[model samples]
Target: MTEYGYFLASEDYGPNALVEQAQMAEQAGFTSLWISDHYHPWNDVQGHSPFVWSVIGALSRATTLHVETAVTCPTVRIHPAVIAQAAATSGILLGGRFRLGVGSGEALNEHIFGDAWPRTAVRHEMLEEAVEIIRRLMTGDEVSHQGRHYTVENARLYDVPDEPVPIDVAGAGPAATELAARIGDGFITMSPDREAVDRFRHSGGGRQQGQASAHGGMKVCYDTDRDAAVRAVHQRWPNMFLPGELGQLLPTPRHFEQAAQLVTEQQVADSPIPCGDDEEEHIRSARAYVDAGFDVVLINQIGPDMRGFFDFYRTKVLPRLAR
Candidate 1:
C-alpha cells in the first residue's frame, strides 16, 4: 500500500520546530517522517542545519511515526563504521521504526574536511563500500575493512537492534539507480519518475524477500495565497531550481546563494511543486508518485505555514488521497 509522510527539512527548521512538526504530522495522519541530514543550509535564507542524529533521538521519544533520514551521505563527512553505530542506536531509539537512507553525497556536506571532492563514479563506489560496512557492523559482529575510500579497524556496534537496520540507497541518475538496486534494501529518489522505479525493480532490486520499497520525496508550498507562496519559495528555496550537477558540486551555502541568485520567482512558480491550497493540485502532485509505483511519498512544505499545511493535508488532501 502507498503511504503518505511528512518530510522535515533540517535546513529550514530548528530541531525543536522539526520535532513539533513531526508530532503535528502524526496528529494530521502522516504515517512516516523523512528528515534531511546536512551540515549547512543551501543558503543563508534557508538557514538551519541541526545534527540529524540528535534530532532523531528526540524524535524517538516524541512520536511513534516511522522516521528516515531522507538521505544521509554515509560515504563522507563521517566514516561508515560510525554511521553504523549511529544507525543502530537510532533503530533502538525509534523502537525499530527507523531506516538509514544513504546517498553518494554532495560537496556541500562532504567537502568540509578539506578532502578532494570525488567524481560521480568514485562517489558511487565509495557509497557502495560504505553501505557494505554499515550493514556488516549492524550485524552485531566485529568488522575490519580496509577499502579504497575508508578504513575501519576492529569496529563493531554493541547496541544493534534486534533486526538489522535497513539501509535505503538514494539515486538521482541511472548509474546510481543501478547501484541502489544492487546494494539497497529500499530505494530513495526525489521524483515521480516511473522509468527510474522500473529500472530499480528490474535491475536486481525488489528480489530480496519481496519487493523493496520505492520512496519518493518532493517539496510543496501550501498557502491560501498562491502568489505569496511562490514569492516565499523564491526567497527561501531558489536552490531547488538549480540545474544539473550544481547542487552536488557547490561547496558551501554562500556558493549556493550565489548560484541561486540566477533562479527567478517565475521558475519556482512554473516548477511541479504544488503551491497554494488547491486541494486537487496537492492531491494530484502526490498521486503522481503513487501512480509511478512509489510505496511511500514524502512531502515537504517549503514555506512558513507548517501548521496550516498540516491542517490542510489532514482535512482535505490526505482524506482525498486515501480515497
Candidate 2:
C-alpha cells in the first residue's frame, strides 16, 4: 500500500502554527510529514519563514509524525559540514525518525551569501560533493576532503544516530535523477513523472524509496462558502500560479510577487487547487499521486482552514485510499 503524508508549510505559517499543524496531522493519522526549508517566504504577501531547523526541532518534540526536510539546500548558504552536524543532531533529537531531503538550491537562498550563483552544472557538482561529505560524516567518520568544490579538514560528527539517517535527493530532470540514483539513498520529486522516476532507478537510486508532492489536490476548504476557501488560497498562496524558469529559480516571496502580477484570484478559483465543497475531488487528486507510482505522497493544504482539511481528509480521503 502507498503511504500518505502531509507537508508542513514552514514558509507560509508561524512557528506556533506549524507546531499546531503537526499535532493536528498526527491526530489525523498522517503517515509522514514533509517540511520545506526556506530562508525567506519569497514575497511579503505569502508571510513567514522561521528558520526550518528550529521548526524541525520543535516538531520533533511536539508530534510523533515521521519528519523529513522536504528539500534543504546544503550546497551554498550553509556548508555541507554544518548540514552534517545539523542533520546528525536532528536525527538524534527525533530518535532516528528524520530523513534528510536535500537538493541543489536556488540563488534566492544560496545567493544571500554574496557568492556568485553558479549555473546548474556547477550547482550539481557542488551538490555531489556536499552529499559525499554529509554521508561520510553521518557515519561518524573522521573526514578530511580537498575536493574541487568543498574542503573539510578533520571534520567529524559526534552526535550521529545509531543508524545512519537516509538521505533523499530531490530532482526535476534526468541529470539530477541520475545523480540521485548514483549518490542519494532515495529520490524526491514533485510531479507524477514516472519517466524521471525510472531514470532515477536506472541510474542506480533504487535502494531507499521514491517520494513526490502534489500541490493542487490537497487543499481542504470546508467552509459552507466554498468561494471563501478559494479566496483564502489565492491570497495566501498566489505563488503557486507562476510559470517558467522564474517559478523554479526564485525564492518563495519573489515568486509570489511575480505570480501575483499575472495570476488573478479567478484563475486560482478555476484551477486544480481544490476550492469546491466536494470531498471526491480532493480524493481524486490525492489518488493521482498514488497512480503515478510514488511510494510516498505529500499533500499540501494551501489555505488557512487546516482543521477542516484534517477532518475532511480523515473522514473522507484516508478511508477511500486505505481500502
Candidate 3:
C-alpha cells in the first residue's frame, strides 16, 4: 500500500502554524511528514526561512507523525559529524520516528562561508563520504575519518536512539540515483520519473524505500483565489520553475531573479507549478509519483489556504486513494 503525507515549507509557515498543520494532517489521516530544510527561500519575495532542525524538534513533541527532512545537505554549511549529532538527537527526541534525508546541497545555502562549491561529480563524492561518516557516528561508536572532502577525529553520537535511523537520499539523475542505491537507506525525489526510479533499483537500490513530492498536488487556494495562489508560488518559489542547479552551489535569490527573468509564467506553469484549481489534476500529479515506484507520496500545499487544502485533499483526494 502507498503511504501518504504532507510537505511543510518551514519558511512559508511559522512554527505555530507548523504545529497546527501537523495536528491537522494527523487528524486528516496523513501518515508521515516531509519538511524542507533551506537556509533561504528561493526568492526573498517568499519572505521566510526558519532553521529546520529547531522546527523538527518542536514538531516531534507536537505530533505523532513520522518526520523526515524532505532533503538536507550535510556536505556544506554543516559538517557531516554535526549532521550525525543532529540526527541522533532528533531521533531520540522523536522516539525513533525520524529519517535523515540528505543531498549534495546548493551554493545559495553553503556559499555563505565563501568556499567555492565543488563540481557535480566532486559533490557526489563528498556526499558519499559524508554519508559514511554520518552512518558510522550514528552507530554510537567513536569514529575518525580522513576523506577527500572531510575529516573527523574520534567523534561519537551519545544521544543516538536504540534503533538505527534511516538515511534517505534525495536524488534526481542517473549518477545520483545510483549513489543513493549504494549508500542511502531510501530515496526521495520531486519528479516521479520512472526511468530514474528504475535506474535506482537496477543500481542495487531495490531494497530501499522511495518517496516523492507532488509539486502541484495541493495548491489550497481555498481562501485566496486561484490567481492569488499562482502569484504566491511564482513570486516566492520561482525556482520550482527552474530544474537545474537545485542541488548545486548557488548565489542568492537575485541570481535566480536574473535567470527566472528569462522564463515566462506560462512556461513555468506549463512545466508543473501545480498552482491552479483542479482536483483531478492534483490526483493525476500524485498518481504519477506512485506509478513511478514511490512508497510514500508527500503533497505540498503551496498556497495560503491551508484549511482549504486540508479539506480538499481529505475529501476529494484521500478517499479515492485510501483503499
Q: What does candidate 3's lDDT look like per residue over 282-313, in tens digits? A: 77777777787777888878777788888887
Which number leads on TM-score? 1
**Model 3 stretches astray by more than 4 angstroms:** 208-224, 246-249
RMSD of each: 1.1, 2.6, 2.7
TM-score per prediction, in order, is 0.98, 0.92, 0.92
Q: lDDT tens string, model 1, 190-282?
A: 999999999999998873445347999978999999999999999998887899999999999999999988999889888898989999899
- lDDT by residue for model 2 (1-323), tens: 77887888777888899889988888887888989888877677657888888998998999887899978999989999999999998999999789899989876667776788788888889999999999999999899999998989999888899988888888877888888888887788876677877787777666643333221124444554678878877777776676655644675466557657777878877876667558777777667767766677777777666888788888887888888
lDDT of 2 at 108: 65
* Candidate 3 local Cα displacement, residue 300, angstroms: 0.6
Task: Rank candidates by lDDT, best first.
Answer: 1, 2, 3
Q: Rate the local accuracy (lDDT) of all candidates.
A: 0.92, 0.79, 0.77
Cα lDDT, model 3, residue 266 = 62
lDDT of 3: 0.77
TM-score of 3: 0.92
